[model samples]
Target: MFSPQGPSLRELCVQALSSVEHGYDLLAPKFDHTPFRTPQSMLDATTRALSGLGPFRTGLDVCCGTGAGMGVLGALCQDGTTGVDFSSGMLGQARSAYPNASFVRADARALPFDAGFDLAVTFGALGHFLPEERPALFNGIYRALRPGGLLAFPAGSRPPVTSIAHWATLGFDLALRVRNAVWRPPFVMYYRTNTMQEVSRDLTATGFTVRTVPLSPPGYNLVIARK
Candidate 1:
């Protein structure tokens, strides 16, 4: 659902046809007013979860759309925080919202940082990366963190086939597939392509020690990968 302040249906249709970066650029201004933005409930849970794992120094937010992870990281980390996203439009919103925090425009697959951060987090941005793109993405995140640094995010579990969510997500993924099959500049978001097992394997392959814990929200879990 979207608020009155959010983009109109026509605007969403236009965004759907654009490349992921451009689509997000178009959507960035009103992102927080839409359901697509990471909810405060999840951010709050992330903050609470990371609080125990940290007395962290520097923090990074991978694919930091509108800097949702900035607030989460700020609450947990003691010093510097940065939000990295490819979209200039998204970074603009983030800059306006958190002027004191750093924001960078860079692709997640080629993150431009050394092992400088003690902690990192991502929110609601994974679906844009294809299954094959994940290794590079994970590697970049892993490489950005210092030794013993943690990269964390709230991960969703697969819903059973009998459930409404399962069918809904399946339908959504199917629609995206069909759209990509017929369109140029394909939008990369999908509902069910990635799995926890696959993600864990990727993290491990990238030299992370991976683990998960049940988050406060009933259906979501947190995947923590330590460098």
Candidate 2:
């Protein structure tokens, strides 16, 4: 699923062996060319889904790798848009791409912001954080949003048990578990942990009124968490 401009198999293996942060740093330069990058169609669908709730002021994009979600913020927010990511390499690429937007280097688990944003969005980064880590990530996002602010993200519906996608995802997670069990600096990525019910519960616990709206494509949902 990688293009010629993307990292090679050897490069990917090297990355897989490293910590998540360093791996991403090594892959950052060619990240946009990879399938791992959030697709443009997904971003457009997210933008359309969030438009009705907007006329927002400042916007924040958590775990904003390469700033793809920043485009969503730029379109919806009137004041300014900011992207926060822990990887300096990713932040550099993001800053280069969207020179007008602000970029911050900080972990999503311990976001370094107050109630300064009216809206926030993240794309295709949920799997990076494990279930136990969700509390810190969501709590930090809650604190970063102003009263009556919103945090939106897209989540896919689970595939049917009979479908190949189901087995594929299950296999992927199993492989990741085995790797973590045997390797150092485990790469945390799982497909099944962030269910809609689980995420909604976490958001509610963090004081956000959680709700879901159908996105453009079927089997995808845009979760809106209001502060």
State how far residue 72 of model 1 sits from its true place (Å): 0.4
Model 2 per-residue lDDT tens digits across residues 76-138: 999999999988889999999999999999999999999999999999899999988999999
Alpha-carbon error at 120 in model 2, in Å? 0.6
Which digits, one per residue and each the tens of the lDDT, describe model 1 over residues 26-103? 999999899888889999998888888888999999999898889998898888899999999999999998998998
| TM-scores, all models, native as reference | 0.98, 0.98
Local accuracy by lDDT, each model? 0.91, 0.92
Residue 227 deviation, candidate 1, in Å?
0.7
What residue pairs are clashing in model 2?
none
Judge candidate 2 at residue 113 and give its lDDT: 94
Model 2 score (lDDT): 0.92
Q: Candidate 2: list runs displaced more than 4 Å.
A: none
